[model samples]
Target: MQTEKVTQHIINWLKNYALNARVNGFVVGVSGGVDSAVVSTLCAETGLEVLCLEMPIHQAASHVNRAQEHISQLKKRYKNVRDAKTDLTPVFEEFKTEVSLEGEQAIVDMALANTRARLRMTTLYYYAGLHKLLVAGTGNKVEDFGVGFYTKYGDGGVDLSPIADLMKSEVYKIGEYLKVPGSILKAAPTDGLFGDDRSDEDQIGASYPELEWAMQVYNEGKTEEDFTGRKQEVFKIYKRYNRANKHKMIPIPICEIPKNLK
Candidate 1:
């Protein structure tokens, strides 16, 4: 898709939604990654107040710096770029001391990583309430609807997802079209939960392009026909995470008696 049309579509969509909800602006967690960079630019183009938050733990200095750089460039184009950083190390330490955390170090690390995501979400909501801004999710279709590579109530919790329909590669295309900083566009995508070297592809063992291809096939109602190589691997990833986190996507269950029983 052309950058101009996509940009206009996003602006029109947000404007209508903002007016309907009586919102004054939009807020997004800028991870210094491509997805959030594109989202921030799109939101800013709508002439809405776009607040970008950089919530980093101890391991995100490099990513945070890149995010700041992107935000700086965005400010030149959009007047509403503001940043706030909240370090989550102290909060994680306190929680670790309170709870008897058991399991391997990997498990502990995963828990800490999830804590950081939930903290970011909480901070976004707090600002949203204060500013009457809609929380814009930066997750793309490949991650959100395909592999489900997100926390249950962490980054997954959002008022709206602007790029939910675009794949990760498509998100990069949009970012390039919007003239996002080359430093951000070229940076290896990571969640900044572990060290700077850790990445989602490292954890999932699949590339975004491959994941999106499998997703498109599956969405078109195709079954797993090939049982070899990356195809099988992608299927396993899709099934495992989808089945494991099914509860995350559903509402809490409740038991009730029939009204006539009374």
Candidate 2:
């Protein structure tokens, strides 16, 4: 994939985008995941002001530690990089108190998980506005396009996505090249939204490699019927998520009136 060339391309793209937009730099929500680590590092490479926000809401200890470690290393390596931590636990608790938690337990938990993401999104935009920075997205191809595994108006809310076109494996490759903290690079991927130890594989029922394979085969005009056993199961899982989360992958629906009606 011409790793060095790809890395320079993204860095130049980020630099040009920020310059064209007249923004100082970028603000990225670092979650200690490979995606965020790679993204934040790329933004730093642009040699512009990059703010990394660690907004945690009932986050797991391992996740928090990894996030801190990555941020620390980034700040040390890049003079333009700085970080801030906002403990959103109290804010989240207050929000829960104001809202009714009436519904199925699973549904309610899911909603709260999304709320955590939205809260971080809000915090990111707040800093972006204050610092004249663009909100840099950390989503990769599989999550952003293949599975739609992000919260709309939440983590999906961003001014620009630097890694959306790269697959998850590609992102890891970039992470390794960028020298991201070992703890983060070795950790299993999770959204950290549920405040649990469950990995993204647990939630999606498929690993990134499996999903990438399914995405490729599906895009190549292969159907679930063409596979059997585990492959079929993975394909079905990918298809289900793609269908269910199509709303996130496409433009919002708008009602268009007929000319006569107008």
Candidate-wise lDDT, in order:
0.82, 0.95
Top candidate, metric lDDT: 2
**Model 1: colliding residue pairs:** none
The local lDDT score (0 to 100) that residue 241 gets in candidate 1 is 66
> How many clashes in each structure?
0, 0
Measured on C-alpha atoms, candidate 2 has an lDDT of: 0.95
Error of 2 at 168 (Å): 0.4
Q: Residue by residue across 1-262, what tens digits does model 2's lDDT show?
A: 8889999999999999999999999999999899999999999999999999999898899998999999999999999999998999999999999999999999999999999999999999999999999999999999999999999999999999999999999998999999998888789999999887899999999999999999999999999999999999999999999999999999999999999997
State TM-scores per candidate: 0.91, 0.99
List residue ranges in candidate 1 displaced over 4 A.
250-257
Span of 10 residues, lowest total lDDT, candidate 1? 218-227
The deviation in Å at residue 245 for candidate 1 is 2.8
